[model samples]
Target: MSADDSVLLHTEGRAGYLTLNRPRALNALDHTMVRRIDEALTAWEHDPAVATVVLRGAGARGLCAGGDIRAIHRDASAGGGASSRAFWRDEYRLNDRIARYPKPYVALMDGIVMGGGVGLSAHAGVRIVTERSRIAMPETGIGFVPDVGGTFLLARAPGELGTHLALTGAAVGAADALLLGLADHFVPAARLSDLADGLAGAGVPETVARHAATAPGGELAAHREWIDSCYAADTVEEITERLADSGEQAAKEAAETLYTRSPTSLKVTLAALRRARALGSLEHALDQEYRIACAMLTSPDLVEGIRAQIIDKDRDPRWTPDRLAAVTAAEVARHFAPPAGPDLGLGAGGAAARDA
Candidate 1:
């Protein structure tokens, strides 16, 4: 429990507690954090003393915001994409391990869970969210296609709700997360500590039952039909056209939001989602996303988007192929093709059988 530990590891009863320690940074995952987590989880996986694992962020504001996007920005700008690739390779493996964990894995998703944060928790055996929980996959806004098995989760969402969320990068609360099957239980923020205490004794399922209650409610389900309809198109161009023409205000708003994101990301993500739907396992989706991630590292839109929205704080990104019509099928295909480097290492089983 050292204050300086980026990830604090401790054992209480049968529960292994992992605390993400960079509260000031919103517990953003870095390569060190990812490696530390991998080490801890690998060690704990076979320890008979630990029956389940509970993960949370140290700060009250949230679990984790995402991977340190600033780091990605820096690495992408440096060229070669060597650093970015290494990060994703290990991070994606952690995501897969969590999903197929041998023991119960509980994720307390409190607030601001997005991007890589979603990667760490979405596949947990039991995902518990509080009223303060805000979850999303916002890669499109930064000119990056969603990775860390995002395609698998989003592709599995009811209807095409995943498409809307992916394209818009909209943050949804606990109720919506539960509705979308992204989370398992809804606990109030105030009761989270009690919930954790119980987990140290009775384990996640029983502990969650003790504190779980009806979620306040959310609007995502109401818009499912709207989302599934507009996003049903095979391409980003068609989806936007349909959304723009729809009479519903939600559709119009969605259209506006999509317009603000990277056209390259929107198109590539759409293709990824479609491919994910046809895949047999989560590993397959990660392999597909690895290709996309490598492509994004060199894409003009990714650099410009990160500069405008993050580094420069300008909010406005002059995206190359700014319009859907300008994005060619060949260009999108190149994103899905394997980059000239070591593969993502998912192997025949993809990420599912990745070594610890």
Candidate 2:
């Protein structure tokens, strides 16, 4: 499909609606989609007719799976580093724009929301989820650190739960998302269409309250304390050792999951989370992430990870440092280093414009 066909835009009454249209691809974003979204949001920002914005995916499967990474893999194969960088830059700007948007933004995060999906919904003013929603970052599986303001949001999750989630690329259902502060409202899947039809100038809260159901208890509750203790360590080595020593089934499971991911992705992700916690704002975190993303474009394991997991379907990536211990402190440090280009030009006035 053409780039313009990827996003279907519409307006009804006072609400502006966006339907991610590539159901076959799970609406995986490309540079064009990001640019189109930025353009639309910018125009709608000043239009008094648009009092609220509603965003959702078209298919039953997901809001979005992620960036068009297979496309990026193609670019990597052709040595199109500059093209990959451009895509990330535009995507990051779109993310920043959403975070700073003026109108009341509502996201129907009703299905598989990971990577780019999280970037789209996590910053919305009114984030909605349903029983079908399965949210995660899951970038480490592709041999990359989370980006598109993921580092910023994940850092603020309660205790070390964020750390555990990021490293493991584990998918969590809607209730778990609410517990992580990744979602705001829990409306059932059946009522989503009704909610959109009923939205008028300023009635979203009341309408949502009427539809909101009591979400099922989060699975994280069972292992929160264990995750907090084990993932809170200063280093990945320490965290794995602690988990190994604990003998708790959950802790052992977490360590095993960590081992399955690319070691470079894990170590760099840990450093990203650490630095993100100390950063000033989402823009700051995105800048840090932009650097890491640029690094990912150059990593051999990224190509291999996608080859095994997505291309070949073997599910076995030969990461450069195949073992965790081989990923040095300096190697971890390099991913956080400043990029050769300018920082993500997200500007200084966004956070004030949009409420966190």
Q: Best by TM-score, which number?
A: 1
* Alpha-carbon shift of residue 100 in model 2 (angstroms): 1.1
CA RMSD per model (angstroms): 1.7, 2.5
Top model number, lDDT: 1
| Prediction-by-prediction clash tally | 1, 0
Model 1: per-residue Cα lDDT over 1-356, one tens digit each: 34349999999999999999998989989999999998889899989999989999998778998988888888888856788898998998889889989999999999889888999999999999988999998989989987889889988889988888888889999988987889999999999999987888896667888899999989988888778898998778889889999889989999999989988899899989998999878888888888898888879888888899889998999999888889999999999888889677574654345863
lDDT of each: 0.88, 0.86
lDDT of 2 by residue, 33-84 (tens): 8878877897789898998899999889999999998888898878657778
With a 3 Å backbone cut-off (N, CA, C), the pairs that clash in candidate 1 are 346-350
